[model samples]
Target: MRRESETCTYWSELIAYLYGELSADERSEFERHLLACAICREELSGFERTRAFVRTWKARAEEAAVGLPAISLGSAPNQPQWRQALAALREFFALSPAWLRVTSAVATLVVCALAALAVAHAELRVSSEGVAFRTGIFKRPPAQTKAASSEPLYTQEEMERIVAERIAAARAQMLDRIQSEQLATREQAQSMPHPSPAQASAQQPDFEHRVRRSEQAAVALARDDDAPRLSDLLSEISD
Candidate 1:
């Protein structure tokens, strides 16, 4: 009953049906259509024939009988306690330089990891007790700087300039939309050849409202237009 996108082709459904995994209702419907649809019927028949052929070959395959040999397990050579200790020492000295380096690196890494875990545990305890880790050996992130503060990434002025540009773009867009709406309202009023008494009275309020709105918008735009340029301010500060 799910509505599907027309753009999504039915290849996935066809694959499911080919695997004999379609729901009974869907399968029955598909089969009923297959009786009249030659292409689907032929494809289904071909798949069925391939499956039968594969099963036939499987049935004829002779399974190889495996015989495991009686494996004689070897025992370790018995050595005296002193000889065993000496052999161990010999083996340690026989290790290649590469293996020695690998062992040393692994040991160093494990020691470092354990030290980090211990330090982190102590730091977490301090944090849980409301004590800042930054006061001692650990350090916290730097405090937030002022918006007007200088940074290596960008001068305070540059960031301000970008923000100002964005704000100006948004204001311009909003102004355009308001103007277009006002123009549409004027067109609508002019299109009407005549107005009734009640309609004329209604028009008066709308006209007054529009005039007030226009004046407010004009004032807002004028102020925004004369606002200090962010880029210029930054340039002056940089100098």
Candidate 2:
């Protein structure tokens, strides 16, 4: 009965013994038991066989890892040409310098921004009033006080000068508006109360306590009432 119990106990540790994981005294005791026990010796042999099989599998995995280039060369049949090309392109991009990637991203964003601005600035309308040309960024197209005539009244140079003047004036107005808004924001920020050092130190723990209290309150409310969940309230608001 004792030998049966020991066998049962040490059955789980057979692999550990086979792999030399047992301490020196434990291993010595197990070895002495092995000499007397046929069942333990058979179990140890089975564990040794399993270990040898795992080592063989590991050696094959290492060989496969080392032979990946050859495998890829021979197995081009599995993947489509476009998929392979895309994978190659992805690998190339992955290896690109950080600065190059950043510059590419910035250039793409700038192009998109410029394109959006150009679309916004362009105005094309065909109505009973007649077609008009309006492409200025900030200023409205000049109104025609005089009736439209086939003959050109203003020379190209005069038109260019007028457009330039309008652009300059519009730019100045925009700059003034921006500066005023910035000044107002700065003044408002300055007027706002700032916490003292003592208040600042106390605020962190107070803020955390308030958050915990709010969470507890919410949980209590949820448990007390069969009211709609917070998610449902949010979804209703969104709708």
Best by TM-score: 1
> lDDT per residue, candidate 1, 19-98, as tens digits?
98999998887777666766555545655544544433333332212344323223222444345445544443332234
Minimum summed lDDT over a 10-residue window in model 1 is located at 1-10
lDDT, each prediction? 0.61, 0.61
Stretches of candidate 2 exceeding 4 Å from the true structure? 1-9, 68-239
Clash number by candidate, in order: 0, 0
- Candidate 1: the clashing residue pairs are none
RMSD of each: 37.0, 43.8
| Structural similarity to truth (TM-score) of each candidate | 0.32, 0.25
Predicted structure 2, TM vs. truth: 0.25
Best of the candidates, lDDT: 1
TM-score of 1: 0.32
What tens-digit string does per-residue lDDT give for candidate 2 at 138-230? 777788798669876776556657756765576567556655655665576467578788976776685566556555654654454464544
